[model samples]
Target: MTDHAREQATILETHGLTKDFKGFTAIKDINLSVQTGSIHALIGPNGAGKTTFFNLLTKFLKPTSGQIIYDGRDITHARPAGIAQRGLIRSFQISAVFPHLSARENVRIALQRKLKVSYHFWRPLRILDQLNEQAQATLEQVGLGKFGDVKAVELPYGQKRALEIATTIALEPRLMLLDEPTQGMSAEDVSTVTDLIKRVIEGRTIVMVEHNLNVVATLADQITVLNRGEILAEGNYDEVSNNPEVMEAYMGTTDAA
Candidate 1:
């Protein structure tokens, strides 16, 4: 494909997407497209409907009106498991991992989904041994190789988040929806995970809801800013960051004339 064709290839799209809770509207008439292999950031102040939008796309919450098209198919009514099966996966702000399981075991569990035995824990342990090598490789990819034998709860906060990324990678997702991937972390840990995110962006598209402007500025190919459940601005970081409305939305005021 030519450069133009590649840039035009959209991996996910939402048309007039909205969600309502009783009489309240969480997200209203949102239309967005994410290009293939691009990092798209959804940013806004608190309660900007970022998480609601993610839920709608992941089928965790059904949209009140509009369609969710992924890779050219409408999946608005698809189940969460079905959505995940199609290679659209999400990671939460909180580190998600098996607290008691070893790091290798956690990744192996995710890898088992590909083998079509995600719930076959009753099967022979030897059957899962086949995934051990791949699990180790994934751990290494996320910089957790040396901690494979360590239990997830025993790992440091940063390593725990790394393990979560490792498991997410083991599933081989085509599109990843990362919700606050750097939510609560030290400056050093944030930088480390940011680099990890950059390293993993090859060959896949990422839609992230990030509050860290630095991370968004560094990684996002495009940005959509939201306020009060509607889009306030859409463009590259330089464009959105400089918009007077975006500045007011974020800082409560723009520069004086």
Candidate 2:
């Protein structure tokens, strides 16, 4: 694509983004862009400001300075809830589901947001029941069709993570910010979630922070490497993987994966 076409395809962009604490700068003077239909991976050693960047994008933490443009609008000052309502949704690094709620109920809640009835207690139970079919279908999409009645806390580790993704999918986001979607999973589970991610990614963009280079290789169309809260390199997996600086940042080796 031409430069203009590339610019047109960008769904999210950050300009000079930085965040500072009393004695710490979490991330600094960063400019990044995410294309509308790509899986962009952020990779680096721990404390590379990946989560900080995610917080900034979701408006959970206001940038100390800079602008965040999303889908052609300046949302730098938007609130988290406002941004989510506008279709910029994110999943926490940790699996986030209501432990007490059944898998179907967890997904149902996310679906409720789409119908704008999350807080409609006055509505009859039947009104909420209307979401059950969609919720079950969402569960099936994530390979949890038969586990809909299971409580989230009762699920295995990988299944819990799958439930989280299922709920995220129910929201129908335009961009999905997945923070370590495969963290702490067994090798078998990693493959499962990786495949699940591919299946669910038809109409939306995904920006993921992942440590598994193999997963990044299989899933990422673009890669950005960060070191000491600054961008160290940007390219596809092979490009970043072969950079001496990127290798050095990963403790002087490319095997940091």
Candidate 3:
């Protein structure tokens, strides 16, 4: 790909993005670009406005100023559903699945939603057997093939997270936003989730807010560090990870936290 195509492949871009809640600024003058088919990580301490930034991109919250461009289209004022229709989707840190439903059923519902199938009050979900197959295939892709028959609430926490990823990918988004994707997992679980994330980004762009520095170092092609409501540093892992500003921020937070 030519350099320009490489950049255009950047499925998501933000220029001078700012968000304010009353008089409190949640994100300030942030400029970010995520290359197509690459893993770009957003990292910071708690309450750093990472989630707020996500809300703006996904249209859960409107920006007070600036622009959000996705897939070369201006989406600054697009609604959440409108953005999703344009191939941008986000997964929350909290599981967005039916706790009482089977894993396959959860994914099946997601597929049905993506396809905009009518929700008939009396129609059985089994009527969409083809969708079930597709859901199973997605589960397999996220390493949860065996858990398809299990109830979502019964699976281990990590598997639930994997299921969430499966559901999001089932939407077939060109840009995927993941918020704190590895929260509340053991070391082994974290590694598994990290690998799954890497696998998922093979053909699409991924922008994620990750707390673990190790995960960022392993998967991030580019990194942006947020503090309070503004970007403190932006670069590759080595560049941002070793920057004096990053170290000071971490140190200051550590001392305070």
lDDT of 2 by residue, 1-257 (tens): 99888778999999999999887999999999999989999999988999999999998898999899999889999999988988899988788999999999999999987677788889876777889999999999999999999999999989999999999988889999999999999999999999999999899999999999999999999999988889999999889988888988887766664
* Model 2 TM-score on a 0 to 1 scale: 0.95
Which residue window of length 10 is worst by lDDT in model 1?
1-10
- Give per-residue CA lDDT, model 3, range 7-104, as digits (tens): 67777889999998889988999998888888999998788889999999999898999999888889999889898888898999998889999999
Tell me which residue pairs clash in candidate 3. none
Please list the C-alpha lDDT of all candidates, in the order they appear.
Answer: 0.92, 0.93, 0.88
Whole-structure CA lDDT of model 1: 0.92
Model 2, stretches more than 4 Å misplaced?
Answer: 1-4, 253-257
Tell me how many clashing residue pairs each candidate has.
0, 0, 0
lDDT of 1 by residue, 1-257 (tens): 89657536999999999999998999999999899999999999999999999999998898999999998789999999998988999998898899999999999999987788878768888888999999999999999989999999999898888899899988889999999988888999999999999999889899999999999999999999999999999999999999999999888899822
* Total backbone clashes of candidate 1, pairs 3 or more residues apart or in separate chains: 0
Query: Which candidate ranks first by TM-score, i.e. highest?
Result: 1
Q: How many backbone clashes does candidate 3 have?
A: 0
